[model samples]
Target: MDRTTDTTALPLIPRAALFGNPRRAGAQISPDGGTIAFLAPRNGVMNLFVAPRGRIDAARPLTDERRRGIPGYAWAHDGRHLLVVKDNDGDENFHLHAVDRETGAMRDLTPHGPIQASIVKLSPRHPGEAVVSHNARDPQWPDLYRIEIATGRSTMIAENPGLAGFDVDEDFALRLAARLEGDGSQTVLRPDGAGGWAPFMRFAPEDAMTSGVLGLFTADGRATLMLSSAGRDTAALFRLDLETGEATMLAEDARADIGEIIVRLHENTPLAYGVNYERNRYVALDPAIQPDLDALDAAGIGDWGIQSRSEDDRFWIVGAASDTAPGVAWLYDRKTRALEKLYDTRPDLADAPLAPMRPVVIAARDGLSLVSYLTLPADGGSAPRPLVLLVHGGPWARDSFGFNPYHQWLANRGYAVLSVNFRASTGFGKAFLNAGDREWGRAMDDDLLDAVDWAIGQGIADPSRIAIMGGSYGGYATLAAMTRNPERYACGVDIVGPSNLETLLATIPPYWEAGRSIFTRALGDPATPEGAALLRERSPVHQAARLARPLLISQGANDPRVKQAESDQMVAALKAKGIAVTYVLFPDEGHGFARPENSIAFNAITEHFLAAHLGGRAEALAAEEIGRSTAQLLEGAEILP
Candidate 1:
């Protein structure tokens, strides 16, 4: 395979401009509505910043994290403190940190190293405390605790006792838990007040993921908001009575599962819930909030989300997103029905030409509906152009309509990007998700091939110029596409993808032990001889000798999910087979590139690789660009040049 050496004079959007850290993003309002808090760069690192509600310009930094940035945070009921989650050097063992906004003091609430902490519930009734879960006691399951914000003290609320999840009410009290059974089913348990728990409901393995609790209803402790796929193809939002096991449907979509619930902070009442099939759509449940929803819809710029609301629910900090416009924040004053533009996430791309992402549905060879998003180059004529078949990571996760930086970057480089939600994608209900079970490289890969054929039939993609690229599971699919149908893609790129399913399952993080049964049911139970043979048959590493196209691979050294060994073994196999490949490794990152410099460098090399194989436009990698990041080229050194 020969690389494309011809260079075009098209304007090159700098890699840093697309992949560098956002100046400021994710703005939210305080509970009292007196101040707003958001993430912004402080000393070259992202930190918590707060400002008065009406005067966001006076925002000041509250945390001085210098290495990795805070991933997420929430305001405490008192408004003077906030809870944040951050992982060390991308190891993914997140620690909960409580910060004092007044004195800029911070304490690690869960200081146990490599133990993940997650918020189970939070309420104004417990002003300076939150129900948190920590897996320090057991790597396979987490135990619940009431963590105090003021003293960083923790009181054990509920021990894991071999349960998968603990359900809490509006008062931050644990009421129910889902326990994984030996048969891969789940038994929902309710506490009997005397410390013993009894089964309330049982879900078969097929229905476990489709049916789950949202939270206990604020109006009635005995009733809870739940999602159930029982007696239906798609999951629906329902108010379920715990005592009688009766349920009433609230909001539902024929084609997708019920998504997240939007709740009022103090009152704990649900305002609306979300559904995402092609794009995200909200179903308003509370009539009082309908007018505010209408005003946000009328803004008509992009998808709007309520970031934070005042206690009285009069003022809302909203975040708007569009395919062309990555992000923009607004202050929506509900009383006046006005949207005041606050800031642009990427002001540099404000004027850059971006392609429109259109949603399309194509039927697979097996007649399954495949929902996909396509973004074509702005200047590329209505003819067959180079295509990048970008697959999403979660075979369990679905791709939605949104502003994706990768799609924009590839489109600007003159390639049509197609991201397909193959059969197993969520939100489409239980049947579609179930169809992906045990079909890893078979029906799943066929669906991707069918998508390419559809694009070629539509004259939107050049069949001879198509390349496959993805991360994680999508990365595994990239390897599968190249090996199973070597004549299809011109080249391929895989990031943090597992090559051998057997080793992949065996090396899963210890903390994921509780969910191993789900994986076994979804893929193959590698613990059995039959499952071992099936996994080996589907593994791309075992079929490396059939590789017919060049490949680019990237892996993070510290990735906790898809370990670096996955990439190493695949590359070793390819090397032994004398197959063409480039491998890049990041020393200071995990699952994916978290640091701005590492992200920029990875994308730069990737752009260079795509241009070499597909003849697309690329910003030539400069020496300084390569020197700035921690990315080390392990093989195929020509990818950067």
Candidate 2:
């Protein structure tokens, strides 16, 4: 807990370098292992780039995305084409595009309009085609399709019968489907060979989110792999017999869920699996892959993971990263045992005075243990510093230790940063996750308060100068913190966070209808009187009059989940109460800022705001920073320097 280093002499790290586009990232090796594809800035926007193996200098942009960058991409089994998904301004209605590596031609395979398209399965067994799901036929449920990658022709393979998700096999055949029942339980179904589906397995409401069928384990489809927490607190990997409905445990962790399973290419067999508690631990299941795992562990890299692998399993694109560093991708050759560094994700940060992140477990007021991370200023010397309690979104998602730009950025600006994995966060056992149900602003907010109390008790935070900041669910927590305990925080920042749970549930996207029961069960249902009362009592917008701290709110105008109205309503509530609040809006953004300019611009404003209230050191804003971004200061522009 002692942070006694003199970090005050270090030069300020630029906001752009921390939040801007990376030079190169998300590297994926082609199936044949002859080429590597990654994302790099093209004309200031992130685009897909390709290069021959070991020839990153000769990389060329394959997809020229001018506006919003391509979020993610994958290589087809043939390796002649790449598939990328794009959504408009963060609307989350993703459309699948196929880019020909040979001709640089891009074709929208799912050009059906405004529907969310996701790649279900791609395999070497079906190199010519891919199985995809889209809500084109019905807005509420997505139907499956077999699409030709080369010709862009689509054929309906299966119609969704109100199912939440489908599991397709290596041959692009539907093997199992899961449906969310009205009480928030889940039922897995298998095709009955007569064009109908029969129940394969049923999960209780408590195990709904923690357990489900992963996919078929074998090529014959007689056996499947699943994650089930039905009898245990933590979800475990199991090999289920499709014929007998019997499940045999493959792997389990006492502290965490089996988060990831690494499978062999085309065969769909598990080679290794990972469980993350304080840090990630990978266990090799196949003897043939044990040496490879050992080599990575001995490579002197910090927390490495296999990003991409060739069909033959001889070559792997491994990305190694840590809390203080961005990421470095290495082309690992199994036969040669050679680890060749391909590129640094952010070479600009190589020599920066970055702080170290320490994982700590704090006890909640009610005796629950909260896993948290603390990052102190690199030069902070035996003195309590201003702290920013940074909460993560997903209220369902847990924060893990890694190269977090926000942590580094805040610490560089003379502030201690703390991120807590509160109750209800996944990866922990089901008991911890289910405890968060309907807690939202109640016990969940209590967890954040307890973390702040721990930081103060450890002499790491100046309690009077503390701030609360986050996006989505995190944003909601920020607002709740400032309102519920107005004296606890000096300032708060909310990015795309909902102010009213009732409206948030009402405005959810149509495609999410199948999982409505899950939301209702976790959050209070607005349809029932008691549920409606609970939601109103927990909503932050209703308690705006209690807000005693300076607040900054930002929103992506196109965000489909937490719509602009969420921010608008909060700002309006503050205005009606004669309170001053700064509001920043991006007309072309959704959910979160995808464009780097906007991200840099928002942080530029945020730093100044924090500096004013929390007395933290801040880099002066540049005219070019604001000019380059599409940020519209809807209110309180005078708050910026």
| lDDT leader | 2
**Distance (Å) between predicted and true CA of 123, model 1?**
0.8
Runs off by more than 4 Å, candidate 1: 1-10, 265-267
- List, residue by residue over 313-349, the lDDT tens digit for candidate 2: 8999999999988999999999988999999999999
| Candidate 2 clash pair list | 6-379, 7-379
CA shift of 253, model 2, Å: 0.8
Can you give the lDDT of residue 344 in candidate 1? 85
Candidate 2 regions exceeding 4 Å error are 1-7
